[model samples]
Target: MLTSTKTGTFRFVLVAVLMLLLQACQAGEETTPAGANAGDETSTTASGTQTRSDEGGTDGRGGTLVVAMTAGNVPLPDIVPTEGSEGRRFVTYQLYDGLVRWDLSRDDATSVPRPGLAESWDISEDMMTWTFHLREGVKFHDGTDWNADAAVFGLDRILNQESEWYSASLGGAIATYTKKIDSYEKIDDYTLAIHMKEPYALLHWDLTWVRFASPDAVKTYGNDGYIQHPVGTGPFRFVSMEQGVNMILEPNTEYWGEVPKLDQLILRPMPEASSRLAALQTGEVNWAEVPPPESMEMLRQEGFQVLLNNYPHMWPIILNLQVEPWDNKLVRQAANYAIDRDGMANDLLGGAANPAVQFMYEGHDWYSEDGTTYSYDPEKAKELLAEAGYPDGFETVFVVPSSGSGNMWPLPMIEFLQQNLAEVGIDVEVEVMEWGALIQTYRPGFPPGENVGGVMVSTGSYAPMHAFDRNFASTSVPPAGNNKGLYDNQRVDELLREVQVASEEEFIPLMKELNSIVTDDAPWLFVVHDLNLRVVASNVKGVVMAQNWFIDLDTVWVE
Candidate 1:
C-alpha cells in the first residue's frame, strides 16, 4: 500500500454479500427529466439475483483498497453527466461507464477514443464525421438490454436545457467545432452512430466521458437524487448514503466485465487532513491522498508505498475583474507584480510545484514560448498602483476554503503577497469557508463586487487545453463551469475560441498570444502545477496510476 501527508479537509464508500437475485430485471422505459420526480413508478428489480450475505464479503482478493482525497463529494444526479465536482468522480464508478473509456496513458493524459459501448469507429476523409460500431450482448445492471435508444436517451439528458448537466468544462466548446449534431442512429439493436457538423479533434476525446445509465432508474430517483441508489453496468452497485457522513457500495456479480475482487467499498468523509492521515496509520481507513512537502517525510517513515506521476492540474490565484480596482488593468497588473512566483514555488511548495508562466504548463509539447514571470518587486507594484490612481494601494478581503489544503496551502503565497503589497500600502483581509459554500459564493449569480478579491486553489486531473480555457475564459462562467473570477476580455475570448477549433499549428501561436495577454492583464496569478503524492500498501499489486489518479481502480488488486 502507499501513504503520504499534507493538510486539507475533504471527503467517498460500498455494501451486502451476494444473496439477493431478481428473475425479472428492469426493462426499457421513457426518458426521465433532469431533476423531476413526483412519486414516479419508474422501474424496480426483484431481490433474488444473488444472496446478500455473499455480496460484499470477499472476492478472494486479500487486501483492502483505500484512497485519501482533499475534496468532498457533492450530490450525484440521475442523468449521465460528463463533468462534475470532485465527489462525482468517486461516485460515478459505482453507477456508470462511458461509451469509450478515457486513456490516461496519453502524452497529455487525455481521453483517447476506445471501445466501451461502441466496438470500433470510422472517420471520414475530411475528418468531419465519425461512425461507431457498438458491441453486442451488452446489458445494464438492471438486465435491460443496452441499445441505441438508451445511448441517445443518456446523451439527450446531458444536452437538455432543463437537466443542469455539469458538462460545460467538457462540452462548453461544443458550440464551436460542432456546428450541428445530426442524430444518434440506431443502426440495429446493437449498433450506434454519431454525425457531426465539422471536424472536432476533441470530440473523440470527449466521447470517453459519455457514460450510460439506466433511463428507468433515473426516472425513479429523479435528478440529483439517483446517486443515493444508482444502477449501472459497472462492477459495483450503490447501497446507501448518509449525507456528510459515509457512502457504501456492493459488488455486482452479474457485471459483464471482470467483477471486482472486493465485495464492498466503504467511503468515509474525513474533512481534516490530520484525521485522514491518522485514520490510515491507525487502520481506521485504508488509503488517502498526500500533499507534497507537508506530509512527505512522515508517510515515508511509516513504510507506506508512495506513488508519483505528472498530474494535469493547476493552482491559480484569481482577481475578480468584475469589481472595482481590479476592473482597472493597471490595478490588476500591480497585483501580479507584487508576488514572487519562484520564492512561492521553492518555499511554500517545497519545490514540489512548478512556477507557471502561462495558462498551460511549460512541460506540454504544444507549449511554444515562456511568458513573462513577474519578479518580486514591491517598488514596481507600487508604481503600477500609483499609475492606476491608487498611490497608497487599496484594501480588500481574500476568501479561501476553510478546510483542507485548498485554503491552508496558499498561506505562504498569501503572506508574500501581503508583505509586497503592504510596502505599497495595500491592506488585505483573509476569510475561510468550506469548499461547497466557497464555490456557491464565488459563482456568477452571487452579486457583483461581493468577495471580489479572493483565491480558490485546487488540483485535479484534466487535459491542459481544457483546463486553461475553462479557468481563464469568461465564456466558461458557471452555470457553464469554473469561471470563478468572472473576467471578460473580448480579445482573449476571441483567441480562446479560435484555439478551441484550430488545428495543432494554429493553436500553438494563439495559445502563446493568449498567455501573454493574461500575464499582462494579471487577472490571475498562475501558481504552481502540483505533483500529486499517493500512497499504497505493499500488499496491493497491479496498481495502474494515471495522471488523473481516478483510473487506478481498474488495475488495483490485493497480493
Candidate 2:
C-alpha cells in the first residue's frame, strides 16, 4: 500500500464536500464560453457607433468598480509587478501599455497581437529587424511625451545592464521576452527599430509583455521610488494606494484611445475565498475573482453573474528531472496516466475548468492531435510503473501553493490527485506553502527540498512560440529562463531553433510537432485548464471577460 507522511484526510473531506455540492447544483447549465454575449445587449455609443452594452443596459460609463483580487498582498504599481501573474493582471496591465498588446476586445479562443502604444510595425525580409511606428500625441500620466527615446529608455531598463536605470529585478521577470534582441535604437521621434541577434518570428507576441513606463517619472522617483509612484500611458491613471489593503485608479481623460467608462477603479487584496464571497454578498465589492467553487451556483441564484471562460492557463506539477525515478520516462508517463483530470475539473472545480491532455487546450490552433493522450487508466499506470522496475511505486514529495492566481483550489485538487496516484502505487507526500514562496522555486538555483519530486504551479500556454521556448528550451533552464523542470531533449531543441526562423505557414506544424514530443516525454504532469472564473454584481456592466489573462477594463462601468 502507498503510504504518505502527510495527513490529507481533511483536504479529501473538503474535496468530497465540494464534489457533493457540485453534483447537487449541476443542472446542465454550461459555462459561458469566451466571446459569448451573456446578458449583453446592442447599444449605440456617443460617437453613433453600434456596440454591445453590459446587462444593466447603460452606455457603460461613469461608476466606481471595486474588485477583490486573489493576492494576499497588494502589488507594487510598477512595470514588473510583485505578486506574480496576479500583479500583472491587476496592476501592470492596468497602468502600462506595451508596444504591442493582446486583442482583448473580442471573445475568442486565442488573442492575437494588436496595436497599443505603437500604432503599426514593419519587419525586415530576414525577420531579424523590426521597426515600430509609435502613436503620435500620446503622453504619459506624468505629462512626459512618449517618443522613440522614451521607448528606447524603457527597453534599456530591462535589456541593457549598463544603463543607469536598468533593473536586474525587473529584467528577470521579462528576460524571456527580451533575450533575443541584440539591441534597439530610436530611429526617429515616432519610430524605433529592434535588431534581433537572430531571426525571431514571435517578436510581436513577446512584445506584448514589454510594456513601457514614463522615463521622467522613473528619473524623478528613482529606481525604488518608481514602484510607489508609477506613471504609464494606459487608460487608467494611478491615484492612491493603502499598502496591503487597496489601490485606487481613475480614468485618464487625455487617454489617446477610448477613455475608461468608470470614474474610479479600486483593487483590493483578499486571499481567502470565504472573504471574497462574503465581500461579494455584503456589496463591499462589485467584482470578486476565483470565488469558492461550491458557491458558484449559490452566487448565480442570488442574481450575481458567475462567469467562466476558456483561457490559456494550465495547473500542472513541474517534475524535477534531476530527481530519481522522475529521470525515467516511463515513471513520468505513469504519473500522467495516474491523474483523474475529469473528476478534478467537473467534480472539484464545479466545471470551472477543462481537462488538459496536452499543454494547449484541445481546440487550440497549436494543440497537437498526434501527441500522446493521457487518459485516467490506473491499470496502465501500474503496468508502466512495473515495467520501469518499480512494481511497488516510489514515494516522493510535492510542493504546492495553497492558493494563487490561476491556481484553482489547489489543496482539494492536490488531495484528489493524491488519492488517484496512491491507487496506482505512487505514494505522494504533499507540502503546502504560500503562493509567493512557491513562486520563488520557479527561478534558477532554487534547490528542490529533500525527497522533492515536483512543484505544482499554474502556467500560461498563450503566446505559442514563447510558451514553447520558456518551458521546453534547454537554454531556458533557471537563471536564464523559466524551464524549472530542467528538461532537455536534443530533438526538441533543434525544432525550437527552426521554429524561430520558420515561415508563418511552417510555424504551426513545427509547434504541433514540438508539442507532440514534449507530451510524449511527459516532463510535467498535465492536469487541467482553468475556465477563468469570477463573480460580478448584476449591476456591473460591459465586462468582456476575454479569453486571456488580461482584459480591457475601459469598457466596464457600474450601473
Candidate 3:
C-alpha cells in the first residue's frame, strides 16, 4: 500500500478491504427484534471469532502490544458518523463500545451480533421495537453512567438534523441503521427502546456500529474539542491521539470485563507494507496488517506468523450507470468480459485475493455459481462497444483511492484496467485521490459519473445486506451510503429488503436470486474477492483476527 498524502494518485491493488469493513461502519436495526437468547448465547468464547484470552486459549500475560497499522486519519471526527470513513482497529474500537459488536471471529461476521455495552436485548413481536437491557455499571472514562439517557443522547445526535454529522455529512456507514430509528424511548436507566420506521432484519447487526459516546464528554469537549480528548466505555481508554502519528491507549482498569492484558496498545500508521514488515522484524511492532506480498514467505520462514482470512470482500470496477455509454448494459458487460479477473488477482494481489463473479467471496453461504459469467474477452468487449455505437472505445476518467486495504492493489488494478479498456478503443485518464474526498463524488443526476467521479476504484464488502444496501439499493446513494455509481433498480431494492426480513432457511436462495439480478444488470465491473493478511511477531498471542478489518486488541498480549 502506498503511504498517505493529502492528495496523490499512483497505482497499487489492496483496494477497499480495510476502508469499508462492515465491522467499523457501526450502525444498528428492527421488528419486535428477536431477542438473542443471551443466557446461553452470551459466551466469553465464540468459535473462530473474537474471544477473551481465557476463551481463545492462548498463552500470554501482559506487555505492550505495538501494532503497525493504518492511522485514525481524522482525530475523533464524529464517533457518530455523518457521511465519513474512519479507521478503527487502531484506536476507535478501543475507546468506544456500541450496543453490540461485530463478531469478527466468525465466518458469517454479519450473522449475529455479539454483546458489548448492551447486556442483552429483546425484539417486540411486530418487528418495530427493540429493547436493550444495558449492562450494569458500565461507565464512560469521564465517569458518566452508560444508561438509556446516554444512548439516546448519542444516537439522537446522529439522527437530529441540527447536528453537524446529520447536515454536513453523507453517512451511509452507520447511519444506515440510525436513520431507521423513528425514535428511542427510555424504559428505565438500564433499559432502552429503539423503534424503527420499518422492520429491519439485521437490526442487531446494524447496532454493531452505533457506538455510544459519553454525553458528559460531548458537553464538556464539544464536537471538535472532543476530538482532542475522546472518552468511551471500552477496555482500552484513550490516552492520547496525534493525528498522523499513533493513538495511545491504556487499559481501562475499571472496565466491566477483565482488564486488557496489554499494558499499552500502540496503533501506528505505517502505510507501506515494507515499513510495517521492517518494524515487525525489528521488534518495533508486534503486529502489522497487509505485509508486502513478496515478503510473506520470507517472514514466515523467519518465524514471524502470517495470517490470512477471507470474507465477503470484492474489488469491482464501479461504472457510472447514470451516464451514457455505461448506461448501456452491453457496454458494462463488455467491460466485465474484457478484463481477466483471475489474472488481476493472481498477478497484482500476490494471489492473496480470489477472482470475484459476484459480491460475496468464494465458498460464502450466499455465493452463486451462475454469477461467474464474465471472463477476459477483448473481442467481446469490442463487439459490445461497437453495438453501443462506440466502434472506437470511449475516453473516461478513472478515480482510485491513493491507498486502501491492499486487497486488489488498486494502483496496479487501475493501470491494468487502463490497458484492457484501451484494447477495446477506450481511453482512461487515471486520477489518484484520497478516499475521504473521493466519497463526495457519488452524487445523484444523469451523467453523474462524468463530474465528481466516474470510477471509485477500491475493494468492497462481503456483507450481503449492507453490501446490497450500500451499492445497488436505491437508498444507498451519495450523502447517504456508498452507492456512488448510482446503480438503482427497484427489484434490487425489493430483494434487498426481502432477504433481510427472510428467515435463515429462506435467505440463501433469495439472496442468490438477487445476485443473479445484479450480475445480469452488470452495474459494476466485477473484479475479485479481496483477502486479508496480517503478520504478527512470535511473542504476540491471543490475537483474534476478524475477517472484517477491526481487531479485538484487548485479547492480544506479548509474551
Candidate 4:
C-alpha cells in the first residue's frame, strides 16, 4: 500500500511506551531478492547531466529508515570516546551535534559548519583565544539546559588522559595548546571563552567533534552512564539500547531545527555480508552500510539506491621496520614496487577503491601532488631484493582479518600481492585472524622479542597532525598506540612537528618531504583510499554528504 506522511512536525504520541515493543521483536530474516526492476525506468538527464532522481522514497509507505550495518557485533558508544569502527559514528551523530558541520559547499572539502549549540564565535587577532557565543533556549535529551558549562564538562572529560574517552590522538595535539584553555569561563549564561596556549587555526572546526554531556545524565548513569541513557542537543533523542542486539533513536521534540520526519530510527547489526544485503533487498531494512560489491551491483541493477562518497580513510600494508628482513630499505622499496594496487582497486574492490600513491588522499586539501609514486615493476622488485642482500628472497608471515573488506579482512588482493612477492623469491605464509584479535596482536606491547612480523591494517586519518605524528613519528613506539611496527625516524618526526605549525605553503613542502621519506624507507606498501557506499532509501530526504563523516540527521525527513 502506498502511503505518505507530511514533513516538519513530530509524529506519534506515546512513542516511549512503544520502544520496548519494537525491541522485543527480533530482527527479520533476510529479504528475498526481487527482479532488477527496482531501478528507475526513466533515464532522462537534466541538460546532459545523468543524475539519479532524488525523489525520497524507498517503499510507498514510510516510518523509520531501518539501516543494516556490520557494527552490530561491536558495542559502540553514543558519544565517540576515540577513533572507532565507522558504525559507532552513526550513533554519535544522533546523540551530539558539532559546532560548524562540514561545509560541503566549498570545493576543497571544507566543513560547512552551521550553528549548533553555539550561535556564533569570535577568533582573537593573535589567534590564541576563542570566545564562543552559545545558543540560548537549548536543552539536552534529558531536559537539562544546554550551556557553556556542559561544553566545558565534555571537553574536560575527554581531554583528561585518565578518562576512557580520552583518545591518544586528541590528547597529543589538543594537549599542546593546553595553555590556551585558560579556563572554560561562562561570560554570561550563553557564552564561553577558551583560552589557548598557542595559535590553532582549526579550533572552530575542532569544536564540531568536541561533544558536550549533560551533568545530570552523567551523575545518574555514572561510569557506564551514556551507554544506555545518552543526552545531547541533537535532532534525535536516545530511547533505548539492547546489548548485542539493536538500538532505537526517536526524534527529539524540543529539537531547535527542522525535526526528523521519521518517528524512529532502527539500527540492526547484521555482520554477515550476504545477510545484510538480503535485509536491504527484501525491504526488511531500508539501507545498509558497506555492502559487498557483488551485492551493490545486484541492488543497483535492480533499481535499488546506492551512494558512493570518499572518506579520509585508507587500507595499507603495515611493514615491521624493526624486524631484520624488512628492516633493510631495499627490501621495503622492492616490496613497494612489487605489489599491484591497480588490480586490487578494479578487481578485488570491484572499482570502488582509489589507488593511494601518497599517505594522504588528493581529496584532503593538504595532500602533496609532487610526492613520489612507486610504479608496479616486478623486475625492479627482484633487483632491489638482490641488492638488499637477499638474492634468494626471504620468507615471512602475512596476517589479515577474516572479516570486512575495508578493515581486518583479506580479499583476492592479498592473494595477488602474495603471488607478486613470490616472483621476487619472497615466500609469504598467510594467517587469518579475527578482527579484534588482529588489532590487539599488532598494537605495541607484544613482549620483548615477540614479533608477529607482517599484517594488513586499515588505518584511517581525518587530521594531518595525528596522521603524520602518530603513524610516522620517531618517538611513537608501540603500546602508546603510535607504532604498531615499532618504526621510528628522527627526520620524519621533525618534519611532522614543523608541518603542524607551518603555514599552508610551508606545510606542503613538509608533506612532500614526509611522503618521499616514507616512499624511500618502505615501511608500508601504500595502497588505496576508500569511498564509502551510503545507501539511503527513496523516502529519506535532506542530507549533505561529504568526504568527512559528519552527518546531520536533523535535516533528513520522510515525505
Per residue, candidate 1 scores C-alpha lDDT tens digits across 1-559 of: 1122232222100011110000111112212111112111211111121101111223346355655555555334332322233454565655666666544332223222345666666555444555666666777777887777777667665554444433343244232212235445666666666766544334444554556788776677664555655677666677776665666766677766666666466666555667667777776666665544466556668765555544455666676666777778888767767766666666665555566655545654333465665666778888988888999778876655644433335444555555656666667665555666665555443346465475665644243234545566666675554566777778987876565456544655665677677676677765666555455554555544454534535444555
Better of 1 and 2 by TM-score: 2
lDDT of 2 at 248: 95
Q: For residues 1-559, write the lDDT of model 2, one tens digit per residue.
A: 2233343311112223234001111122322111122112112111221122245664657888999999878888888887788889888888899887876776643566667788777677777788888889999998889999999999989988999999998898889888889999999899999999987656777888988899999999988999888999999999998878999999988999888899899999888888999999999998999998999889879988877677778999999889899999999999999998999988888888888888777776567887788989899999999999999998888888777777878888888888888889888877777677677655663385655788887888667556788888998887777788799999999998887766545667777788889989999999998888888888888887676788788889887
Q: Candidate 3 at residue 101, lDDT?
A: 81
Give the 10-residue window scoring lowest on summed lDDT in candidate 3: 37-46
Report the Cα lDDT for residue 157, model 1: 59
Model 4 Cα lDDT, one tens digit per residue, 43-108: 111122112325355332236767776552534554553224544456766777655443332212
Output the better candidate (3/4) by TM-score. Answer: 3
Residue 529 error for model 1, in Å?
Answer: 1.6
Model 1: residues with Cα > 4 Å off, grouped in runs:
1-62, 73-84, 105-113, 123-130, 161-187, 193-199, 250-263, 291-293, 404-424, 449-451, 457-461
lDDT of candidate 3 over 1-559, digit per residue (tens): 5444544444332322221212321233422222222111112212332222223355466888887763315334346421132254455567788888866554333334566788777677767887888888889988878988888777766776665434234233456556567888789998998888887645766676677778888778776677677788988888776766777889999998767888888767665567778898988888887776677778879988776656555677677766667788888888877877776776666666677766565565455777656768889888988888888877766666645444334556677766777778877776676554454443332233244225654544534555677677888675566676778888888887776566645666776777778887888888877666677877778776455656667677877
TM-score of predicted structure 1: 0.76
Please count the clashing residue pairs in each candidate, in the order shown. 44, 1, 35, 25
lDDT at 487, model 3: 85
| Candidate 3, residue 416: how far the Cα is off, in Å | 2.4
Between prediction 2 and prediction 4, the one with superior TM-score is 2
